[model samples]
Target: MTNTLTDETSVVLANDPHWWRQATVYQIYPRSFADANGDGIGDLVGITSRIPYLAELGVDAVWLSPFYPSALADGGYDVDDYRDVDPKLGTLADFDVMIAALHASGIRLIVDIVPNHSSNRHVWFQEALASPRGSAARDRYIFRDGEVPDGTEPPSDWQAMFGGSAWEPVDDGQFYLHLFAPEQPDFNWANREVRDDFLTTLRFWADRGVDGFRVDVAHALAKDLTYPLRSHAELEEMKLVTDGSHPLWDREELDEIYAEWRAVFDEYDPPRIAVAEAWVEPSRRHRYAAPTSLGQAFNFDLLLANFDAGEFRAIIDHNIQSVSTTGSSNTWVFSNHDVVRHPTRYGLPDDPNRENAISKRWLLHGGPASQLDAERGLRRARAATLLMLALPGSAYLYQGEELGLPEVADIPDADRQDPTFFRSPGVDVGRDGCRVPLPWTATGSSFGFGAAGAHLPQPAGWGSFSVETEDADASSTLNLYRRALWLRRDLQDAEELTWHAHPSGSDKVLWFERPGGWHSVTNFGDAPVELPDGEVLVTSAPLIGGALPAAATAWLRRQAR
Candidate 1:
C-alpha cells in the first residue's frame, strides 16, 4: 500500500516552495568533473569533494548530470538501470554522501531525470522485447507495424533529431520510437503502467533525499499526430513531424503530465524542484515553467545571446518582458554540458590590422598563429564570464567553465563519446567538445585528476587554462569568475533586483540596470565599445581602452540615488 495524498488534505494546488527560483544552479557533469579513484572517471566521491567549492563560488544549488547505471552509449544519457549508480561513478552510498555533503554546504543537489526514455538495454525494454506482442508490458512502448498514414506517401514524416527515421526496427514485428539515439527507446507516457513505473522511479529518488531534478528533454516525451515510417532521404532525411506548431508541444498536453508530477512534488513538503529542459522558443519557454508546471525551464536565449550586443540585448529584453507578463521566475543559462562555451562562440579571431604597426610587424615576422589565437581567445573568455555571472535571472554555470575551460581540441573518432558525433561521423561533433575533464593542476598526466588517465582527455590547452594556475593569479579568468560570483552573492539587492534593460546601442551590446544601482554593460562585439558615464565597476578589459576588446563585458555600480 502506498501513502497517496488525498485530494482534500493534499492541497494539490499549492505553489512550489523550493528555493530554486532566482537561485544560481551549477551543473556538474559527473564523469568529467573530477576523477578520484584513478579509474579515469569522475565519481560521486569526487563530486562531493567539490561541494565546498560550489558553495564558495556562491551557487545555491548543484545539478548533477546523469550518474545512474548506464551502458554509456549516450554518455550516461541512456540509462540501463535507474535505481543504482553506475560503477564508474561510484555506488548508491557514495551518492548519499555527496548529497549530504552538498546539503551541509547549503547547496541543494538536483539530479538529472530522463523520463522521456530509457536505454534499450533497460530491464523493462529487455523484458518487453522478450515478451509476446500483445503483452501489457510491451504496450508501455510505442510499437507499430508496417507504415502508418500521413498526408504524404511515406508514413508520418517524423525524423529523428540525430538524423534518419525516428522509428527503429525491433525484434518484434513492430518498430519502436526514439527521438534521440536508437539505443534510447521512447517510453509511452500515455500508458498508465508506464506512468506508474516512472512515478515509482521518482519516488525512489525522493526517498533517497534528492532536492530536485532537471528533467531531460521533458517536451520530447509527447509525439506529434503524424505516425511516420520514414521521411524524404534528401537533406538530413527531412522528416515532416510536428515541430511544436501542431499539437506536439502543446501546453495542455504538457500541463496534464506535469500536474501528475506536481502531485508527486506536493506529496513531499519543501517541494522538490523541477526544471524542464525544453528548448522551445523564448515566448513558449514559460509554458513548461508555469506556476502549476515545472519550476523553471532553461532559456537558451542566453545560448543564442553570443557576442553580438544587439542579440544579447534582445535576449535580456525578451526575458524581462516575458517574466513580467507570465509572472514566472526567469531562468538564464550561459553555458551547459551540451553547448559550446560562450567565449568560443562570441570571440572572433583577430585579423592582423595591416595599418597597425604591431599587428603588421607580427604578421610580417610570421608570428605564431596559435599564439595570436590564444591571446584573442583569453580576452574573450574573460569577458563572457563577467557577463554570465551578472545576469539577473537564475543562472547556470557549467562545470569546468569557471576555470575558463575551452572546447576539447581534437579527439579521434574512436575516442569521441557523444552519440551524435558517432552517428553523424564529423557532420556535427555534438556536445563531447564541452564535456572534457576540468584541468585541476597545470602538470601531470591526469592534471591532478588521479593516478590514471582521465575519462575524457583534458583539452590540449588545459595547462594554460587550468584552475590551479588561475587560482593563484588575481587577474586570471578563474579569479575573475570567482570575484564576479562572489559579488553577485554579496550584493544586498541581489535577491530583490528587478531586471530592467534598454537598447544601450545595437541589440549586440546589452545595457541592463539592476534594482540596487548596478549597471551591466555587455559588448558582444568583436571590438571595444564605450560605457555610459558612471564609475566603471568590473571589466574584463581595461576601461581606458576605447575598444571593449572583442567580446569584452563589464558590470558597473550606477551612481548613488
Candidate 2:
C-alpha cells in the first residue's frame, strides 16, 4: 500500500523538465530478469547484456530494483551497504557499464533507494548491538528501554508488517523496532545522524549517473516516537492510516524529510526525478507529490482495483483529479514484484461476494484451480493493459508482463524466500510466485533465462511464453504488447482524458478521447459494443463481427467526416 510512485512514473527528460509526463518505463527485477555467469541468479552483467532487448521493447526508461549489498533477508531491500553493489549482483564497474549502456540506447535509469530501514548486518546496526545502552550508535536507530518492572513485555505491541512482534528484544532490558522483518531494523529518522547519512546515500547514487530514484516504502520512514498501542482490529485496517493522528504512517513530518531529499535531488543536472512509493489515502497523496518535495507519488488505487468498468472509471477520475493538485502526472499500474500477477488475479471468479475472498493462503484463497478461468483472466488483462496505456500520465511495465505471465501458483514451499513466507510460517506463500525467474526461450534448463539453472524453479511448458516464441507469433501476448506499445506512442498526448459516451449506451463499456484524433474504447461487459467512427489503430483482441468484444479494448484514429 506504499503510495510509492510505484503506480506512477514512466518516461523522463533528465534534461527536459517534463519527460516523465509521457514515458513508458519498464521495471526489471534483477533477480529474475536475465542471468549472466549463471550462479543460478540474475546480475548486473545480465541486465547490461539485455539493454538491446529493452531498447526493442519500446520502453522510455528502466527502473531497477535494488542491487545493493544485502543478505537477501527481504530480497535486496534489506540493504547492508548503500554505496556499493552486491558482490553477487556485480561490481561498481558493472553498474557504470549498465548505466552507460542504457544512456547510449536513449533510455533513462531510475535506481531504487531504500531509506526506511537497513539490514541488521549493516555496520550501523551491528555497532548499535555491540555498544552499551543509550549510546550514540543505538540512538541512530529506534532503540528504547522495554516496559517497566524487569522489562519483560515489549515497549509496545506494534506487530511487524510481515508477521510476529515488531519489537526484537536483546539481552539487555531494551528493544528495537522493525516494522518489517527482524533482519531489517527501522531507522530513527528523527535523529540527525540517520537523516544526514541518507543524504550521503542519495548523493552517492546520483553522482553515479542514475537519472532518478524510486524511494522504497516512501510512506513508512517517518514514525511517531510515542508507541501508542491500539487494538488489533484497528491496526489491521489500512496499508497506511489516514484517520486522525497515525503514529506509524503518513505523518506531517514526512513532507519535511522529503523536502530535504528534494533539495539534494535538485543539486543534480536538470534536477533528478524521484517518485515516492507511498500508499497513503487519496486525499493525502498530494502532499507526497508536492513539487518542492519528492516531486511524484504513486497512485495505487488502480493496482488494488477490481476489473469492473465502474471501478476503473472511478479510479481514473479520482487519480486524474488527485494528482492534478500537485501538478503531477497520474500513474497507472496493474502488477509488480509484490502483487499477484494481474492475469492470474483477474482470472479469479468475478464473484467478489463469494465466501472465499482472496487471503494470504495458497491460491490467494481465490477458489480452486478449476474456478480460475485462465482465458478470461488473460483476456481481461490485455484489455485492462490497453486501458492503462491509453490513459494520460505515465505507466510502468513489470518484467514478464509483456509475455502475459501469471502467478506461478505451485512453487514448492521449501524453495520460498520471501520474508512473508517465513514470517507467516507457510500460511502466506508470499510474493515468490510473482518473483519467479522469467522464461526467455522455447527450450533450455532455465527457459533461456540463463546459461545456468535459475534459483527459483521455472514452471514446465513456460517456454511457450518466452520472448523467442512470442516474437514469431503474430497473435502472442508479447507481440500484442509490442504492437500496442508501438501504437500507443502516437496516442499519448493529452494531459487528461475526455470521457466519451459509449455507442452501446452501457456504463459497462468505456470510451475516452485524447486531444488529437486518438481515441480508445473498452468493453468490460459480457456483450460486444459498437466502436466509434474511426480507423482501427490497434486492439487487445480480435474484433467480433466488427464490434469490440467483451473484455476487450481498442485504439482508433478519427476518420474525416
| TM-score per candidate | 0.85, 0.94
Residue 542's C-alpha lDDT in candidate 2? 96
**lDDT (CA) per prediction:** 0.69, 0.84
> Which regions of candidate 1 fall more than 4 Å away from where they truly are?
1-18, 148-157, 224-251, 348-374, 492-509, 524-537, 545-550
Cand. 2 Cα-lDDT: 0.84
Give me the candidate number with maximum lDDT: 2
lDDT of 1 by residue, 204-289 (tens): 88767676789999876765434332243532332233334433444347677887887787677677778899866566777777
lDDT of 2 by residue, 28-61 (tens): 9998999998899999999998898888878888
